[model samples]
Target: MDKRDLVIRPIRAEDIGAVQDFLFTQLQELFAQDGQAAITDDVWGLGKTYLEPDNCNMWAVFTPEGTVVGTAAICAYNGRIELLKGRYHLPTTAEVGRCYIDAKLRRQGIGSKLVEAMTQFCKDHGYRTMYLHTHHFLPGGFNFWQKQGFAITIDQGGSLEIVHMEKIL
Candidate 1:
């Protein structure tokens, strides 16, 4: 199918299984795990969070035929807010949980659509800021975020291999 066949929309409960399948099966096959092990079904209460009428939700890019190709999600974050001890952060009242696009469809703006939908979702839900982390190793990982207007709030690019980025809504 062509890019014109794509449709961006909010993710639903029925789509969870397919999303999880893509994450565990398709993604695992594409990446070199290096014995790090495949992903498990335990998603730290993702299903419950999605089901709840809370600040957490997911969005997907799909074909007109109903094939889900990409998704982005967020969850309420009541964890911590150190880093600055002030209101300089992205509000960071919520956390960007998962965002993924099909390998063959990278750079075609599907990811951007997902991110846009999620950011709008946060804004509609009264979130002032959103925080997320991505691996420095991924190709275009940092640039994609930077291009999306997400600033590097915290660069924990040490041995952890993750760089935390935030977008002030």
Candidate 2:
């Protein structure tokens, strides 16, 4: 895909539906299993969790025709930081989440662009590090984040091996 054909920017209010549909269609199994209650808990709270905060945001990559092809987001890291048993300071960290690209658009640098935008946003807003977790289940998941400079902090080697990674800005 030609780089010039895509537009990457912070998501606007009007782009919410396209983002939801794009993500739902891409990861139907996860969302459908819960009857999409996850969307209501997360995507539906975008305004309070992302848009309205100075250190949080959600970005979307749009085609010229205005379809959402990719997305990335940063939100305040919540929960117990001590659970990871790492030297992480929660106040200086932002959680990187909701990163996905259209299946047809992979390997064309769209995901990297979205991550770049998120990292730059994190840097500008005074976040010292970005954190994320991924499992082996998603295609290209570990390699993608590793390429973006995130180092694996923990690899739970059990039935459900979730990998937690972090990148310092």
Best by lDDT: 2
lDDT per residue, candidate 1, 1-169, as tens digits?
6877898877677877777766665446534545444344334354776647577787777878787787777877655546544643334467776577777898988888778788888888888888777767666778899999988877876644668787888
Report the C-alpha lDDT of model 2 over 1-169, residue by residue, as the tens digit: 6667999999877777788787677667434442332344567666777788888999988888888888889997875555575566777889998888877888889899889888888888888989998765567888999999999988875544579899988
Name the best candidate (by TM-score).
Answer: 2
Q: Which sections of candidate 1 miss by over 4 Å? A: 26-32, 37-45, 80-92
TM-score of 2: 0.87
List candidate 2 segments past 4 Å from native. 29-40, 80-82
Kindly report which residue pairs in candidate 1 clash with one another.
Answer: none
